[model samples]
Target: MNLFSEIRSLVLDALAAMQAEGTLPEGLSFDNVAVEPPRDAAHGDMATNAAMVLAKPAKMKPRDIAEALAAKLAGDDRITGAEVAGPGFLNLRLSATVWQGVLAAVLDQGTAFGKSDMGQNRKVNVEYVSANPTGPLHVGHTRGAVFGDALASLLDYAGYDVTREYYINDGGAQVDVLARSVYLRYLEAHGQEVAFVDGTYPGDYLVPVGQALKDKVGDAYLNQPEDVWLADVREYATEAMMDLIRADLAQLGIKMDKFFSEKSLYGTGLIEAALKSLDDKGLIYEGVLEPPKGKKPEDWEPREQTLFKSTEHGDDVDRPVKKSDGGWTYFAPDIAYHYDKVSRGFDELIDVFGADHGGYVKRMKAAVSALSGGTVPLDIKLTQLVKLWKDGEPFKMSKRAGTFITLRDVVDQVGPDVTRFVMLTRKNDASLDFDFDKVLEQSRENPVFYVQYAHARVMSVLRRAAEAGIAADEATLKSADLSKVNHEAELVVAKKLAEWPRLVETAARTNEPHRVAFYLYELAGDFHALWNRGNELTELRFIQDGDAATSQAKMALAQSVAVVISAGLGILGVNPAQEMR
Candidate 1:
């Protein structure tokens, strides 16, 4: 049970009683009323602004409304004290039994303690790491991949029907470049020296693709020009690059539900259909765009082009759909892709992009809004850049990737668990500095280590309790007499556990998975604090001398902490460590 929600219901009931008795107005709205933990624990256990929100509408003084509401709240069995604080704020102190109930709920529910139904099984499409199939994924794509994967998992945990998707960028000029590069490698595999000039890929990772090409079509395209083999080579090279990309994502345990090809939008009338929908809505026209604001390009000139009225939706300017030469602009395909997503009957869509794509956010959101006719909402999350440091210096690029560190390189040095957890230590919009030495160090400063250490400590307690022949399993712990867990130090942990359900709903509502990582760290801190107190107070120890009943009560609390930690880590795609080693 969510204690906060339960208490909020109590407050609402009291307000309803006030209205029925004519002490308050009949039609006042209570939608804005909130019950949450007090900012300062010394103030009370919980605080509410119900009186403050209702006073103006009731034509009454704030303090008068607060005092009346406080009296009604104090009559509840769970509320030990309710005091009217500064400016109609109500601070409530709950009995120890209230916090004790939190522990019981956690034990009874196990890892399902904080699961929420906020999503209501709404279908959400999360598209991320749509990196071009030109090479192995780099550090930037790695961040997007981890963020999107964890977010999908979090949505699923909160009861959303989530579809993980990737958009393959193979229909653009880049794939042609990849084909020519692979063709050069094919020549090199035939014992011919080929120089990779300005526009060709020079990475050694493509050597295998070239060798495979030669083995399949030996001497067929040798000494031939670009026309006869360009089409076949382009298709072959894209599939090979996608194979490499799949392997890279597999290393990090990311599996996509769908890989939508950009090529499919071409020759399939999808792009035309998307633009025609806009035209039917009076959103498409032929026009000349104003010159860009700052630092206009050297070849900048305005020409009449087919444009979409993106500004009518939300974008800063109307965006071009087709260039003057009758070729579709880059924005056209993007609009078509989002149109296709909306047509799939999704309730919501989210795109995880790199920070460099910040300028595209507004136009993309506008496209989705216009295409969906305001029915489907779209959220675009941009993951900032990650700087890698090692031995107190910036890490150099990988030789295999030629220009950047490959995702495999990072995952190889540190395991996938470390990489995933550390990547989420910061929000998606903030830049992160990843220090190899610091992350691997077993210290409290490292969040991954600190959280795992807390879980291990609880595991250690469970093992010792099992050795002592106490029934410490979940079934026994759920029914344990928790009256012995009335100490102030012990109650602090119970209070933190009580916040899990509220946190799950908040994080899911905001589309922020990093909040889960942050909450886990705070919960671990509280658990460790209780464990440290046992060092000084012998009675506070989890295991008491010849007190099996009391020892089981404390073990129940310890097990609850583990259950919540495992649940939180599971949402983040992290494995809770049973032991630090």
Candidate 2:
């Protein structure tokens, strides 16, 4: 199904033949040999670097080897011709039937055509959107949520056993703030005027939590001291905030497999266990760190602290585990969390953090490297900022959230499909400008609308064919005689369809889900190109007038495009639109 792979295999077989014929060395490795689309389409369909990579090893000129290999490659059925280009690059043109077969392959596999085994069933834990559990998820968290969710789904499609998880930061000062905010709301529920002071949450989202608290225990802690209500209200407010966050994620159709609480690490000896693992390896020690190079704090001084020798594994310097105050540093709990993940026997770990957390990446990766002793690879992805634009001006502020835009606000305006698709139209590390006015437009310039329109138009063609009493179901179309439907434009779509499986493996290997978005866009473009050709050439139309045989064959091609679109959207966690509305 992968045309590039098929061509590469042919090239490798030809190289093996050349080795036997004594045209090349006996043991030169083919590891670096690669078959890729030629830079310029006019040269050929595919090109290989086999000659260049093997020339020095074999002690032979690259052009001499390329000419010999090209003659051998020209004998293969899939490769119609092979010729040496500039600097001994071998350009290959695949036979027309190979492109024709790709369409049939797509029809056979449907949406599963591009699914890959690149992950090899490895277990991977993806931790993302570990936002503070003190309020509903804002727009900043929305980008992380969508990026993480799409990444998890992409790995799953690539055959990894992925756990989509969120960390609840409820054991910090933020939860205490949530408790005091809810206490005020609780008093207000009991008919008392309460003023929110500095360091207290004043968002309306918590007013309901406060009212719920008053309903649970009416007038019991009305004027009491902070000791009794602080502990209980903190628990109450955290659960309430999590509910709002879960609802916001649900609006985007995101549901995590797990939500790990930071509070669970408290008093559980978990921090000691994680640190003990490092201690046993002689990584933990007592030392004083030099102050950060630039903009040192006024009170900065050398203080004895328990540290982890993170520099041994690639950190810029050793990191502190516990401060001189005997309390664990913020890094300690995170180390324990990752240690727990490693002990669970995961084969790999991926953390999706905001771009602001860039400073923490090295130490975190060092911890995983030490904890797993290089057995597991940890990959960290940082998503950049998302700027909002409207009315030719920077559209700042969230109307519903008062201080920031909640994830729900964006989802409600554009729907979950638009939110997921638009977020992925750019690479995760690149800042994305989201124009509310432009994203909602129904035109080719809008990628979301354009991609969805391709799928919708295919469905419309099927519906019209069905009304005309020609069977256009997947089963019927799949059984059509595809050989009768071959054309230059039709073959172009099939060739593009053949790239899906290879594209999936490349995207998964790079841990880049934006490639999936780009692939879908290209696939849609190819399908659209073919669709427009039908307007000028009646024979190019998908539905032939009163000719069910040719109509079934053409419908088969259209449905093949849908198959790839659905699979690509599945990786991005967006639903494929069946209708334009």
Candidate 3:
């Protein structure tokens, strides 16, 4: 059970009882009622805004309402004390038994302790890592992959029906470039030397695709015209590139529920259908766009084109659907793609894009809003750039600079778990520095190591307890005399454990996976603080000679920390480390 939510229910019940007894006004709104840990531990265990929210509505003084509510709450067996503080705020100190119950609850639930039903089983489609299928994924795409995957797992824990999707950008001119690049490799596979020209991809990863093509077709299109080879080679190259992408994602432990192909929109009437839907809504119109405001290009001219009236929804201006040349603009198929998603009846859509695409967020949201009539909400998460560091120096990579680092470059140096966790150590909108040396460092300063060590410490305690002939299993430890856990340091951990369910719900509601990472860090810090404090005071230690019950009680507390750490790491898609080495 969620202790916070459980206590919140008690507060609500007391409020309802007040209304029944005419102590409070009838039909007063209590929508803002919340039970959460106070900002300072000295204040109390939990605080609520019930008095302040009901003040104006009940036509009573907030302090007066708070005083009445305090008396009502103090009567509950779980709340040891409830008092009105400054400005009518009510702080309730829960009995130690309630915090003790959290440990028992964690042992009972194991990794499932903090799982929530906040999502209501609604279908949510999280589409991320929509990188161009030209080569192996680079560092930028790796961050997006980790963010989206962790978010999907977090949503699943919060009870949403989450579908992890990847939109492949294979229909664009980029794939044509990929085809020519592979054709050059195809020529090389026939034992002919080829130089990667200015327009072709030069990554060594494509060399294998070239060799594979030669093995399959035996240079059938060697020295032939583009017409003779372009079609077959484009299909072959995209498949090969996707295979490489799949392997790269596998390295990071990301598995997509579906890979939506952009090429499939061509000649399928999907673009036409999507545009027609907008046309019927009067959102599509023919217009001449103004020359961009600040800087007009040398070729700038007013031209009539098919435009989506996105401003009607939320965008700053209407956007082009078909270019002046009468060809569908790049955004035309994208609108159709999202329209297809909306029609498929997903409750929500989330797009994880690179931070450089920040300009595109408004229009995308506008399209989904127009298509779904605001019934389906769309959240676009822009992941900022990852700056790689090595040997205390900034590492720069760009294909143009001939220094671009691929996803494999990062994964090969550091294992997938370290790579994934380090990628999420910062918020998606914040620039992240991924250092080969820092992420792999075995110290408390590294968040990955710190959290892992907390888990490992608990396991060590379990082993020690086992060797001492004490059963450290959940049944025995949970049944031990938990009254021995009276120290403030030990109870601080229980307080952190009490916030798990609430943390899961909040993080999932905001589509934030980094919050889980931050929570684990805080929880790990609390456990470590308590563990170190035990060094200064022997009674705080987990193992006590000639005292099986107290030892079992402290071991139970240690196991509870591991349970939460495992659950949190599970959401992050990181395996819990049984040992640091």
Candidate 4:
């Protein structure tokens, strides 16, 4: 059902014909030839760069090749016309039957119309929202969670076996701080006054963990030392914070396939094993790094440290694996984590990190490259900040979190559907300004409303058709006489439907789920435009006066739009609204 692919196949066939007739060279490669929508719709339905790409290799003028290719394409049954434009590009207009057939395919496949096999069931590990287990997820982690979840769903729709994982940052100083914070709360529960100073988590979310600890141990830790309480309380508080985190993600309808603990890498020889793998490749060494860029030599301390030759694998500088203090650096555990992922036999790995972690991208990729011997590819996607606005003013922070807004704050203001959809309206790397006033509006400016309105409008049409005694079931509509759907406005929606399969493959290939959001917005626009057009043109309406066949045919096209909309929203983890509130 990929119309672009079919047209590209036709272009390739025409090139083969040219070669057979000796009009082109015998061994010209057609790999670069592409058939895509024309930049301006006025040019034609589709355009190809076949002649321009083959001109230099085939020793022929681009115009001559384009004219010949146009002649061959014009002979196809689906191609109504083909003309050379702008020296070498060939513009093609498909027959009306082709557009009608696209709608038929949509009805036949339902929501699965645009699903792609581009991934070929490749195993992809998507690690995201590896937040510290100190508190509930904040707004920053919310964006990463939504983005990563949507990406995993999008890849799954494109036929990839994706594992959605969250790496718990529990093996760091932060967990120790959380343990101490919970200890203070526990002391407070025992009727003792306590103070939370710097380097300790003081958020109210940890209060429950403290009370739970008091409930469990009672006065056992009341007079105990740090060594006696630290280890037990660290484990206890981490599990509690993780429970809070899991509940927060559940509020957004996000559930990870696995929760990997950073503590599992410590004292397990895993970090040493990962480093040994790199050392065996001659990538690990003890060396003093050069003075950092823009820093004077005196401003920096030159220390010989155990480092990874990350520069050899694409990093800007070699990264240290162990500090000069003889303890492991922060990157050591991350390398071990990725090495674990590669050892799990995943073909590809994607890490969804916050924008603050941008500096770690190259080093992480280099480590994965060194560990996997360049067999597995690592792609890191960074999610930028989200600034919330209410009534044109910056939204206030959460007192519960003590610093930033929590994920529950956003989800509570707007439901999970609106939150998820709006979060994906912008690319992951772009900063988004989420305005509560604007996003909740019913106007076209809100993409969530616009897309949902289109789906709701289609549902209304189906309901009316059902009430009018017209059998609008799937079987009846899919068999409707689509020949009556020859209007330009009707064909526009069908043409957009044809782009779904192509769009899915493109979005999956680039690992950008925002493209799906953008595409769904455009498709909804086309459907809405056609719906508005029916107001002035009586015959274009989904329900005719007495022509049941025509009404059924038009309803078929409308239902196909809803189907695709549902499919796209499903990938975004958004439930399509059947009717507007």
Candidate 5:
């Protein structure tokens, strides 16, 4: 039951009636008409911009259209009052029974109250956490992981067919370095001392991998040169590192639907096929690129390379597909990967990258556009850095990871629920500070704690009702006489509940999951305010003394708050707390 949408429908019907009666001109489009919450709650329950948008098209004054529309709306039972404000805007006041009906609908639907079908079941692939498969995931990957996972869940709730994917960066020089690093560890396992040079990994996490390799092939490649052992060791070390990364993701309750290997695109003719598709459209050419913008002329040298006409789509300059040495550039493989996705029959593609990859956004979008012939759209979201703090000071690096803090380092300090919730408190492109001490504090300043406490408080009310011999189950609450729940304070919470369905569609359309966290916080604040007011006024309490009928009416509102919070937390992949510890 979306009250805003329902009211907008009513306003549209009124405009149609006015057109038929010649009160307003015909052939005016109502697509821009919108009904939303008023900025000042004291003004009215809802506001509409129908008059302002239709005035110029109908060749009529805005105030004249607003007055006619207000009279038509006043005839309906749902709208008790409609007044013209600021010459064109219409402020509407709904009856108390309408807000009460919203609470009853919450009880009827439970956690499924705000689900939407706006996506129309379109196939969408969300690829994230595509870090190099050379080591365990670090703090930067953690932010991208949480944001992407939450977004996938949000799209699913909005009725999209979503596939969560991870692209393994195994076909790069870093994996070669990992192979040599494991070889050093294997030599150490055989009682030989080896020093880690500047190119090899020095983290202690590889000790076990080295031991495992020695157990598999005993003294076979012990003294062999690079050619004899490099290929085998590269395959073995990449598998080991991927296993570590999988475990790190499991720590946060994340399980991807697919893990695409970059090495699979090599020597498989996929790169040639993707480039051929572009070449057939006359987008591929050989040209000499200009020197970089900030480079000195003496330090620059021009060379002929294979280039793609990326500027034709939207990129600032044409991008290189192959280097001068006849080898494919890094962007070549990425193009092939997206072509593979398009061939798999996906309607849309979304890439979640780190903030440092901002330079690749325009080129990547251009490639997908040219490959799909502008039929499919690609959206790229970049997650900013996460700065960790301990005891009001900067946190130190992890010993296991050698230089940066690993994902497990953050998850272990505070459990996965807190880590996931705090990561989404800010926008994906905004920096976040995760303070170990402040997040764990049981205070209102902590958003996770505040939101959790609201759910826990509702549970406490249910328990108290049970002890007092009052029936407060969902079935009983759904059948309660909600007409008695007409207090202004109680109605305020119901009004907020009416916004959930609308909020879900807005957040999903914008691809912003942080808006869900923000809405949950605001709903919690409204609920907490009513709870505090009940202390001074006994009639506002959930359990009225000696009156089970009125008590059930008030308890229904509190229970509805918990239902929405649980749904919101489910979208964020955080478990709703039943009780505070």
Candidate 6:
């Protein structure tokens, strides 16, 4: 069903035939040979660089090789014309029947038209939005959550066994800080006036957590010492914050398959086991790290410590596993967590982190490399900041979150569909501006609206056809005589539909889901362009006047566009609009 792939196979077969006929030398590698859309559509429908790539190896002139290859390709029924361009490039035009088949395939496959088997069922662990369980998730974590969830869906569509995971940062001193903050709130719940200190959380979201603690144990830990209440409150407050986070994610249609607790790695010998694996490979050592570049810290001193030889595995410097006080460093638990993932036999690992954690990428990759003995590969994607604008100014901070806007703040303003679609409108590493006024605007400049409007337009067409008593169901569309869809403007849409399977493979391979959004926009533009043309050109309209056979043929083309849009939107975790209000 992939027209590009089928054409590439045909080109390769032609080259093999040329070799047999002595038009070219034997045994030239075709790995680099590519068939793709030409840079200038005016030149042809597709272009191939086979002659240009094989010229030096085969000891033949590129123009000569291209001429021979063109003759061999002209014998095929699919290719209408193959002409040699500058130097050795071959520009090809496919027959109209090829595009007709592409439209027919769309009706046959529906949303499954572009699903790929490139992954071959390899297990991949994608860990994202591993924010600290201190409060509800903020805007930065929202971007990571959307990106990670969409990536997991894209991988699944590409045939990978993907696991959506969240690593909870609950083992560090932050949880103790949360416990103290909740204790202050607990005192307030007990009718005692309390002021939140600079180090404690002051968000009103904790007010309920404090009341829940009071409801569970009435007056038991009242005015108690730190040792008596800190442990119990830390556990209770962590679970409460996680519940809030889960609710926030649900507001955006994100659900993780696993929520790994950082506390589980401690007191479980897992940390020691991960380090021992590194030690067995001579990657662990007792050494002193050089002071960081630039002005040194006031407390900087040469202290021998347990370190990992991360430099050998691509890190800029060796990292410490233990601090001078003999406690595990912050990076120790992360190492153990990744090591546990590798031990689970996943073939690949992906981590989605906020832009501020760009510095942690090399060290984390080094840890996984050492732990897996260079078997499992890790890719860390950093989602940049989101600037929210409203009423021609910056959006104010959420009163509930105290310092930043919560995920619920964004989702509540615009529903989950708009929020999810707009979050992926930009690349992950690029900064994005989520403008409240602009996103809600129903115009072509808004990608989410443009794509959704196209789907809605197709639904309108189906409804009109149904009222007109024209049978345009799936069965009729698949069996329609698509030869009537012969106009160049209509063929442009079919050509774009033909690119869906290829687009899915490219986006999945590069781990970029924004490309799906980008492609949907382009496809919508082409379909809208054709739709506008039908106003003046009576013959180009979908429902031909009293011609049922011709109308079903053109309706099939419009429905096929909707099919691909639904498939693309599905990968992005956005619902196709049955009708745009």
Runs of candidate 6 with Cα error greater than 4 angstroms are 296-299
lDDT of 6 by residue, 290-349 (tens): 888884677688899999999999999999999888999999999999999999999999
Q: Give the lDDT of residue 245 in candidate 6.
A: 94
RMSD (CA, Å), each prediction = 1.3, 1.5, 1.7, 0.9, 1.0, 1.1
Query: In candidate 3, what residue range of length 10 has the lowest lDDT sum?
Result: 395-404
Clashing pairs in 5: none
Q: Give the poorly placed runs of model 4, Cα more than 4 Å off.
A: none
Q: Tell me the number of clashing residue pairs for each predicted model.
A: 0, 0, 0, 0, 0, 0
How would you encode candidate 3's per-residue C-alpha lDDT over 1-581 as one tens digit per residue? 88888888999999999999999989987789988888888999999999998899899999999999999987889989997899999999988888888888998888999998888999999999988888889999999999999999999999999999999998999899989999998888788888877688887778889999999998589879999999999999999989988999999999999999999999999999999999999999889987787856776878999999999999998999999898999899999999999998899999999999999999999999999989999999999999999999976564531447888888888888889888889999999988889888888789999999999999999998889998888789768788888898999999999999999999998998999999999999999999999999999999998888899999999999999999999999999988878
Q: What's the TM for model 5?
A: 0.99
Better model by lDDT: candidate 1 vs candidate 6 = 6
**Cα lDDT, model 3, residue 153:** 96
For residues 104-160, write the lDDT of model 4, one tens digit per residue.
899998888988889999999999898999998999999999999999999999999
Q: After superposition, how far is residue 193 of candidate 2 from its true place, in Å?
A: 1.4
How far off is residue 386 in model 3, in Å? 0.7
lDDT of each: 0.93, 0.89, 0.91, 0.93, 0.94, 0.94
TM-score of each: 0.98, 0.97, 0.97, 0.99, 0.99, 0.98
Tell me how candidate 3 scores on lDDT. Answer: 0.91
Kindly report which residue stretches of model 3 are placed more than 4 angstroms away from their true locations once superposed.
Answer: 296-299, 396-403
Mark the 10 consecutive residues where model 1 has the least summed lDDT: 293-302
Worst 10-residue lDDT window, candidate 4: 198-207
lDDT of 2 by residue, 157-269 (tens): 88999999999998899899889989999998888999989778777777778889988998989889999889999998899889988988888889999999999998999
